[model samples]
Target chain A: MQGTLSVSVWRGGEAGSFQSYEVPRRGNQTVLDVVTYVQRKLDGSLSYRFACRVGMCGSCAMMVNGRPRWTCRTRVSRVASSGKLTIAPLRNLPVIKDLTVDMTDFFDKWAKAGGVFKPTATRAEDFAAIRPTDSKRRHADAGIECIGCGICYAACDVVAWKPGYLGPAALNRAWTLVNDTRDGNGAARLRAVAGDDGCLACHSQQGCQEHCPKHLNPTAAIAGLKRAVAVAALKGRL
Target chain B: MSAEKLQTCLWLVQRISASVLAVAVAVHLITIIAAVQGGLTAAEIIARVGGNGAWAAFYGVFVVAAAVHAPIGVRTVLQEMTPLPNFFVNALSALFGIGLLIMGLDAVSILYRLGGG
Candidate 1:
């Protein structure tokens, strides 16, 4: 890893092509380090987004070689051991610039899936006691750590195939909200996610689960949504 | 019906029909293999199945389950793969299911009537 690495970075809008740049390889280099090298030294005009340079922000996600990955956490030695790398913007979203994608649609779908929590009780009414071992609480806790990184969205085939379909991350958020015992939007949320473009559209491919940096299972969350929708429909609630 | 309810009901119907089909297909395949292995003639097979209420019911259920299952799957594929309108897809899938049901039931009815039932 002592030689200069050949890196091809996407360099424009939707119709742009990859631009090659050579950067000195370091022993413990990340893909973000390569992009930063290109931006700071090789070409000052290159555009990309990253915060915290660690994995927490999830703002540095890009397609590494062909799959959606958080570039900040991905090791160059691990992905591009052959002294070559291809980095591009996340798929299934509009490219804003070189490596930046428009996240408006991603957030819009989250809203459509009722990802927001609807509180049932006021502060004056005292806190709702939810046991840690409660089945519903455990189900909610399982999917509560989503960071809205859009990696799951980028990795979902259903989202790529049907633009109207709410992707895995949005559906996963809805699942967590649905399982919240104190939430007041259960019926409406179930109805929202029961549509043709919602949970039913998922093929259970597990692409989101596989690509998730946090190892979260959006497929399982979507399955939970499907079951909830089915039960609500059967009970005449949806 | 609303699109959400329709989609949910279709999903339920497809799953239930698939369950029925799982058992029916196994039984149908086993019966076919047994008949072929025992060297039963077409006429002899007809004699055994024709006018038999139990066999008629079994085949009837099998045909119904297949009629329900295949068309829903086809509808999903059309919706996802093709650029067709939703209304057109629904109508086309419904017609396909109806056609299957009619043809399958007709075949079963003819077999039932062949032995004077």
Candidate 2:
């Protein structure tokens, strides 16, 4: 914590190399602080994305030492124990610049996976009282906190292997909707997540669950989708 | 069938067949171990299993489970690993499943016939 840390940051687009920059290490320093220092002081052209310095905004996530992590919450002392840090754009995504990735496909897949909620009742209808202790509500609550962070998406090998496959975050969103008692899109949602590119495509690797900064389990959500799909198929509703 | 329905059905088939294979494999392994431990010779084993209806039925179910389970697994691997067209992958998977079924049933038939049926 008293010495300069050797930080290797990625520069350029699809074709690029790691540019090493030495930064003064301090106690309680986050990886985001290191990147900010490099961009502000060392190099003004260094490109990255971050809104809140805290972990609320998922935009600060990047590949920290070959793992997708929210850099704002990731302490340098914990990650770079060897006094060396390798920071790069998130994997399984298109790199736009140094540390920023093109998130078009990531969010697009979320829509494709039926992550959008449909209303069963019109605005004139009375509010559907869903108790917090309800099993379905509880199930929905478990995965509803996801802030569209691509950490799970980047961590997924299935996403890396099959580009069309709906990644974990999207499926996790779908799961939350599936458990929503007021949601009107149950049948369509099941259909959307049924095929090879949907829930069935998940290899249950739990990479999404493993790296989720929100501590959500997309794997379990996907498994739930699989069961729902199977039930629908059996009931001739799919 | 629609692609979604077909994929879901295939997933169901794989899961069901895998369950069957799980039981079949356990039974097969246990039988092998028991036979070996009992000091049964090749001829003695054949004498007990060749003409036995129960053994034939068990093995017949085992072979079917394996045939169903393996081809689906093979199809998944081919689809994920190769850049093959979906049509070609489906065709190859179907052919593979048929081949496994034919070969498996044939082997079972031979064993059944060894009992002079």
Candidate 3:
């Protein structure tokens, strides 16, 4: 508690190396604060990403001590047991720089999962009243708050093994649309999340559920997708 | 059927086979335990299972379920861990599934024949 913390921050690109730094341990200091200190005081060339400094913004996600976490909210005291921390870029995605990863692939997978919703009605139609207490609406609401942090995608083993996998975040988003009664993209979206690289590829290991900072259960959403795809396949829609 | 359709069917088959295996394994283990309590000797156990229509039928179901389930699991693992293409992986996986069925059926037939089927 009184000594300087030994922090190993990954520097450079995908083929980069970890550079160790001695950062002063402070009371209630977050991991992002530690990185900032290393950047301002120790080294000027250090690169990391953070925006809101609060948990709301998903831009601050990084691998903190081997687990994907929002560095702005993650405290050094909570993660650094031995006063040592290893910070790196998110997994299952290409690293852009020191601690920043290329989110293009992540969002591309999101699009591949049919994350975008197609309206069942146009602006000419009146507001389609969907009851808040409806089962499908409730189901949609469960995974609707995803901030696209790419944390779940980083934690997924299937994504690690199978690069073609849509990962959890994309699948969870697809699930929200699958429940959206107003979303005209039903069978098409289900078909998108079907094949070997789709929702069926998930091993249901719940790694995404476990590491999700928002507490969103992608595993459950994926199970819903599986059932939906099966029904669609049976009905000859997929 | 399309590729996605085939993948979904394979997934369904794996799940259904897994359910079948769950029951079959439980029954098989329970029966083995019960029969063993009566004496686990080869002669005694063979006598209990021998000439039993119900036991043969149960084992036949087990063999079929296992044949379907295991190869799918293997195929998934191989697909994830290996860089093999779909065509090669599919052919090999199908052949493996067939091989399992052949081996499983052979065992079942032997058991039935020995049991005086």
Candidate 4:
């Protein structure tokens, strides 16, 4: 922590290359801390996005050493070796600039997966009174904590291989909504995530599960969606 | 075809082919070991398969499975490189798969007749 850490940051869009930076290290330094220091003290032109430095916002996800991770939670000591670090924008997304990627496409795919929940009731209607112990609620609870971080979206190889793929994060969101008993669009959501570039596109690679900071198993959710879609397809409901 | 139906059909075909291939490949391996252990000569192997419809059928299924599986795999690789529609790509690959089946069967048939099973 006394000597300066050698860092290489991706300085431009997809056509750009990594630029090296030497920054003084401090104790308990996180990767996000290093990036902040580089932008504030060393290079004011550096571009990055972060909010709620405590790791709740999920805005600071990046490819740290070729792995998608939340930099806010990653300690420099854990990732940095030989006093060197390489940080890049998340993979499979259009990079806007240094350490920042255009997330519009990621969210657009999410919308294509019907990520929004369509409720059956209005404010005039009484509460549907869903039981917490219900199996559907329990299933939804398992994957409902996603923060739209794009970590899983970036980690998915299927998304990279098939750019039109709805990806794990989007399917995870759709799965939660599918399990929402109050949602009237379960059938439609099932149909949306049914075919190629949807839940079926997932090869059960489990990369999303491996890199998710929240420990949510999008792989399992996608599997469930596959099963649901299969049933619906067989029954002509999809 | 509807996208959902097409996807399900592909999944079903792959799954069924995988199951069939598992059994066919095991049988083929065991048969090879037996043939070798029995000191089977070229003529002896031909005697077993020259007009044996059962052996031809077994090899026929094996060839078809190989054709289906290899092309499906190649299609996946091509999909990553080319943004072609799955329908056009998969149908083209299926034609290629059929060609492989025809070539494999023709070669097997010739081996049966030429004392080289």
Each prediction's interface RMSD? 0.9, 0.7, 0.6, 1.6
Model 2 CA lDDT for position B11: 93
**Regions of candidate 3 where Cα sits further than 4 Å from its true position:** B37-39
Question: In candidate 1, which residue pairs clash?
Answer: none
- The lDDT per prediction is 0.91, 0.91, 0.91, 0.87
DockQ of 2: 0.84
In model 4, the Cα lDDT at residue A189 comes to: 81
Can you write out model 2's per-residue Cα lDDT over B1-117, one digit (the tens) per residue? 778998999999999999998888888888788777557676666776887788888888888888888888888888888899888988899899899899998888787787665
**Model 4 regions lying over 4 Å from their true place:** B38-41, B83-88, B105-117
TM-score winner: 2
Error of 4 at B106 (Å): 4.0
- DockQ of candidate 4 (2 decimals): 0.55
The CA lDDT at B26 in model 2 is: 88
* Ordered list by TM-score, greatest first: 2, 3, 1, 4
* Deviation in Å, model 4, residue A57 alpha carbon: 0.9
Residue A37 shift from truth in candidate 2, angstroms: 0.9
Worst 10 residues of 3 chain A by lDDT: A48-57
Candidate with maximal DockQ: 3
Per-residue lDDT of candidate 2, residues A168-237 (tens digit)? 9999999999999999998888999999899999999999998999899999999999999999998888
TM-score of the first chain of model 2: 0.98
Tell how far residue B114 is off in model 1, in angstroms.
3.6
Each model's DockQ?
0.78, 0.84, 0.86, 0.55
**What's the TM-score of every candidate structure?**
0.95, 0.97, 0.95, 0.90
